[model samples]
Target: MRPLIRPKMIVSAVLAALVLAGCASTPEPPPAPESTSAVEQWAALEATELIDQLEALPLDERPRDVLASVRQDEVVVSAADGSREVSVPIQDGHYLSIAPYLDRTHDCFFHSLTTCTGEMGNEELTVRIVDDRTGEVYVDETARANDNGFIGFWLPRDVAATVTVTGVGGTAEASVQTGAEDLTCLTSLQLT
Candidate 1:
């Protein structure tokens, strides 16, 4: 003669079991497969982003007659933007003179590839020529600003020299041989 259990007790037991099952949540799936470490992932993402940017860059947009020519110390450089011609006035020794063109509110710091932009006022520029073969410093001096925003100095008597200019934003340098004329370096400088 087993006694029948109360309906309330049965309901409570069922509820309790359900609560227990709910509490025992299924183990979370193993962390999703990570292809790389955090740093590596970041680097990969950056590279991919850069590649995408490069791919999206436009090759041709500006007019071809932008720079007719650019000159530096008896050197004339031709470009689609404009032209620049330069000459050395105080080319005594260890000094490479330069002139940069920029907007009224911006100053130009000497560089081979791009000029650094600074405040509205003019800035004193420094020039240096290094001998790559001997790892020796040949030319080093400070150049004063000219009325036309041009500066000048003399390269050391070294055989081959690399000139460098540093200013506010960045630095640019180019290598040239003595008496090299119409020195145009970059064939195509574009993101695309």
Candidate 2:
């Protein structure tokens, strides 16, 4: 019985050693550097140049609610055409105004929940506006024909508002508040 116990003890020690060897973690290789072709580099620089030029223009000349950043993946579909990706970002309680590439668009049309577009014509679109604070509606008007496809309306400075727009051809929504200054705007994006 003692001799049998010695052999069992030796086998147990060997098994423990094998288990420890298998538990060792392997070292990972360093990540490779990002690759950028000449064309891609040039395109990036061109985009930067365009942004700089646009920044130099007066605020009025710039597109309304020009999204500085985006938080969620967005899909913009057109009944006439196909679709595109639009990632719009915002600060807290801020909204965006989007032009569904449709004829009717305005500064406040696409951004808050207070308003939404009701109907559309060959060159016109309806919009509705909602007040975020009291959950009251502020506007529900169909806009006149627009040369541009869309426009944006920001919250009155420091005021909270949410706006959403939906129709068969398009849909957009955002949360916003008038920020620190009278003209500053902020927004947030939510996925459903």
Question: Against the unseen true structure, what C-alpha lDDT does each candidate score?
Answer: 0.40, 0.39
Summarize candidate 2's per-residue lDDT along 1-192 as a digit string, tens digits.
Answer: 464558889999999999888788565788997985322332233322422333334434543332322112211111122222232223233323444433433443222211223123223545566778777775566654223333344333355665565544565566544554222212221112
List model 1 lDDT by residue over 1-192, tens digit each.
999999999999999999999989897799888664322322233322422222222324212332212122322122333342222222222223344323333322222222212221255656576776676786687754433233444444434666676654456666655443423221111111
Highest lDDT: give the candidate number: 1
Each model's backbone clash number: 23, 38
RMSD of 2: 17.2
Candidate 1, overall lDDT?
A: 0.40
Please give the range of 10 consecutive residues that has the lowest summed lDDT in model 1: 183-192
Give the per-residue Cα lDDT of candidate 2 at 166.
51
TM-score of 1: 0.33
In TM-score terms, candidate 2 sits at 0.31
